[model samples]
Target chain A: MKASARLVVGLDPHGNSVVRVLRSQSPLTLVPARRVGPVALVHLVSSVTSPLGGDSLELTVEVGPGASLDLRGVAATLMLPGPTGLPSSSVLRFSVEGSVRYVPEPTVVTSRAHHTAVVEAELDGHAELLLREVLVLGRVGESAGTLSTSVRATRCGKPLLHQQLVVGSPSIDSSAAGLAGKRVVGTSLMLDAVPRASDGGEWWNVVPLAAGGTLATALGDDVVTVTRVLDAI
Target chain B: MLTALILADSRFPGGGHVHSGGLEEAAARGLVTDEPSLKSFLHGRLLTTGLLAAGFAAAAARGEDLELLDAELDARTPSPAQREASRAQGRGMLRAARRAWPSERLAALSRDPHQPLVIGVLVGDPYEAALTCAYLAVSGPASAAVRLLGLDPFGVNAIVAALPVEDVASRAVKELPALGSPALDLLAEAHVRREGVRLFGS
Candidate 1:
């Protein structure tokens, strides 16, 4: 039992305030297609209306020259089992000419659920991007499943960042790279700009990407503290 | 295998000693204050960063583009402090590698190429390259644990010897998924900023 979901949002400038969302799709699939407001000024605005879990999910987002957009995920996704204990997979591809912000809600790795997601983005010289992800091992008192993630981003066709994360399950010794013992973990990345945090808190571990970008990682005993640190960007 | 053995030696002057690979930071935060904790720390690192580095190292050993491999590595590394530490060591390693291997590939890299990329280019076999990378990834930290926590040297060595380095490399070569540790990343960021006596570079 393998189900699939796909969403493609293409944004181009129509006027100073309103941008055109040339492509938007959330066809009838296991993962719900839900969104609202391509509201003015900052290109198009869209989001995943509900929590999602499927055998495979593919997302392609394109921002036209000088356009800016924000893609949000409303609730955290739980990686439930597919038909035959098959792994859940999500592939996100981005083609950006201007800039894009993707701040999705956390995805919980429940017991026995194995999920892997890959994010690939190609950006123009002037384009910028912001991506944030949070992973929770269990709900209240439970061991975590397995979640593997990969990110590949390019600027002007040059690779800017290629990052990978595999956590939980196999390593019964320590859960989720040892961070689960402390509870929650999150990653925030910003390209072509510095992450300005008004809090000035010491919660985040920050770094500068070689070509051009910023990466930060934070953790907390609870989800709120970790999410709060990620929200700094 | 001989080349990997020589390079994997912490004494190869590749600047591997300068980095704690996040161990110093973790130990300070109380995440790794004891022997069992240290083992878990090393194991976690091996499964994530170690695996990824080995994967890239193995890929690089397969005659991949030097520039392309380094760029891909940059994309994979999300921590700035760790990134800087990597470049610093890379620069040091490149300098040493050029003198030893002295190839056109070594010369093509920028002033400070990444350490794994340098090792990848010089190693003859992908598995060897990966094993070398994986070995060093934890060996450096295990040594650091001895200095910082004054843990039994014998115990630390035992942990290193007990690791599934071969399995990690094999899986890495098969599919190196992107994985990161926010808690460790935070520790690294903090370690660099910590004012008092710092033992290792990263």
Candidate 2:
């Protein structure tokens, strides 16, 4: 897979901004040729550069004024131990001035696999945003590997949100510090323009941000139901 | 250490007894019918929301920006009911801690400082603050389960004692994530809207 991704937006005085993307050198690359929706889908069919485990990624995505982008993964990222016997990692840095919607597929942690994803986003006050993530601890009839995910976002030099989570190995003794021995966890954070409140039902809970946004967290035994609850709100 | 012990006391007169930490509604939902279930429920809370509070408390003890800490915690806590419960407890606890510890830093804060921040200020150490926060997370619920469910006090005490406090405290000081149990978060909100005999201030 391609090891790195760079997206830089050049703002035009006439208001139309131009975007340029830097491709990865590995098999893990974003398919830029397929242009349709606001999603940036990643392709991980072959990892020749990545000898043992999944390839590591250093990805930076920037959206300039009035230009929006959507980033998504092609499918659930399958975690497998690499040469160093370590899990894959993705470090994402986002600069947003316009609207950006990221609807990625769930990451399914397989046995002995490990993955960590971290996102640090800087947003303008007027920028609209939608961010979603889903994690399935293990695939069908298998034990999940280890996973840690963190997102720290700021808007207009003000603190917006700082959250990190670790979904440990299947051998962990369930605690409030972990996922409580559940198999699935999913979250959606929306900014600037949060949708209207829905009637409370399902396992999803929405908390309106004092900083002007909404955070919805849903938990279930499976992904399909959890995604439904998340999308409904 | 002595002062820290005093702060850790369950009967600190900070109005903690009034908050069951969602045990009231959890009991209503039949989620904590026995000792094992209560153990699981408490574990879910500690790893998710409890650890977040512990990290904040630890961070507060170092005397970082109290206002920023408050804002950071606000983002992590997505349940309005939990937020209100925290603010109310913070206000009450600050009042009590001010009288006991008497610091200018405590005075500078809004009458309501988040519970962990207050713990950090008085305790003055990250590990102590985090452990205190973790302990506070379960102590109230353990006591409440005794009164609400009429369960075996011995079993409840065992559950609380069995918690790997050091492990949890260490992990708490490592990070404060905006993560939570969906069921617990939703239950807290539901507990707020219900009319009649709601036991928890949360």
Candidate 3:
């Protein structure tokens, strides 16, 4: 299965943010709020069981100057394998001249599932973006399959953050130098003008990126613990 | 080839021994204690961080722009401590390379280039540079484990010998890798903040 979704948000003359374009395909539903405000809220709902093997999904979001958008997910996504045994992939591209906050639910990589997720965000000088991701290895008492997720954010054509994380290799997954045997991994990336001091604990830390922005990473045995760390950041 | 070997050597005076590549933090937390655990740690390091560094080194050896690679590497390494450690080691290596293998290309590098870039510029061969980087990634940590945990040197040597450094190097030469080690990044940050008698820099 192949799906593509697009969303465009812009600021109106009345100083209100409005959705100019909303295109949704199967398994990629977009719901917008009816109220008019400074920020436009959109909920992303999966209309069908998706991301099965051999599935390819793409989502493109564009935010015009002086506009703000908040995109949220309604439920968790389960990555399952299809009968063909092919791999699944998803690409999210964001072109922002204003601000965008994408908060999606956790994604669980079930057994025999192989998925590759990529997120590319291109921001202008005054643009800002906040992205959060939490990945669970598998269901309770189960082992993960395989997942390769990468995020690349560029500001004014300069790279801000580029990281690719691969999970489900038993040796690396359980090794201290890898995931440290943690079942859950979470990361929160904030690319704004706010300056935050570096802080962390034994398993979590919020640190400043090299170019600009702040990244908070947490590894825990459960989703709640990891989510709490990301929230606190 | 000699340049790669000399840089990989512990006695090269490149100041590579001070950074444990997060092994110190992992050991401090008791995550790695025995031979079996050390093997796992080295293997994991070889696959993730090791592969990433090797890829950058290979790109540099292939004559990629030093400044661009530096910025891209910075984007890949989100932890400040890890970045500082790499630059510090790079500075040390540059100092030595200026006296030994001085060249216009070596001089073109920034004052404090990433360690892998330095290795790549000196080696000038993608595969060899990648191999040198992949080996150094786990070798330092393996030695640090022996010093910090009182593990047997022979056992640690065996573990290091068994790592997949060549395989990682071969793969790294194929393309630039952005593999991020979450546990290693967290450990690097925590190591910097730990308030105690720390032996390694990172």
Taken over the whole model, the C-alpha lDDT of each candidate is 0.71, 0.73, 0.95
- Write model 3 residue lDDT over B40-130, tens digit each, in one string: 9999999998999999999999999999999999999999998999999999999999999999999999998999999999999999999
Which parts of model 3 have CA positions greater than 4 angstroms off? none
Which of the two candidates, 2 or 3, achieves a greater lDDT against the reference? 3
For residues A1-233, what per-residue lDDT tens digits would candidate 3 score against the true structure? 99999999999999888999999998999999898998999999999898999999999999999999999999999999988999999999999999999999999999989999999999999999999999999999999989999999999999999999999999999999899999999999999999999999989999999999999999999999999989987
Best by TM-score: 3
CAPRI accuracy category, model 2:
medium
Q: How far out, in Å, is residue B10 in model 2?
A: 2.4
* Model 2 lDDT per residue over A163-201, tens place: 767775432325322454567888888887745563354
**Model 2 residue A59 CA deviation in Å:** 0.9
What candidate 2 gets wrong by more than 4 Å, as runs, is: A10-18, A33-54, A169-182, B171-183
Query: Which candidate achieves the best DockQ against the true structure?
Result: 3
- Report the poorest 10 consecutive residues by lDDT, candidate 1 chain B: B176-185
Q: Candidate 1, TM-score vs. the true structure?
A: 0.85
Q: Rank the candidates by DockQ, best first.
A: 3, 1, 2
Q: Write the per-residue lDDT of candidate 1 for residues B1-202, one digit (tens) a residue.
A: 7788888887888778879988887777777888888888888888777887888888878877777777777777766676788788778888788778898767777887777777788885888888898888889999999999999999999989999999988887776445665555666667777879988999
Clash number for every model?
10, 25, 0
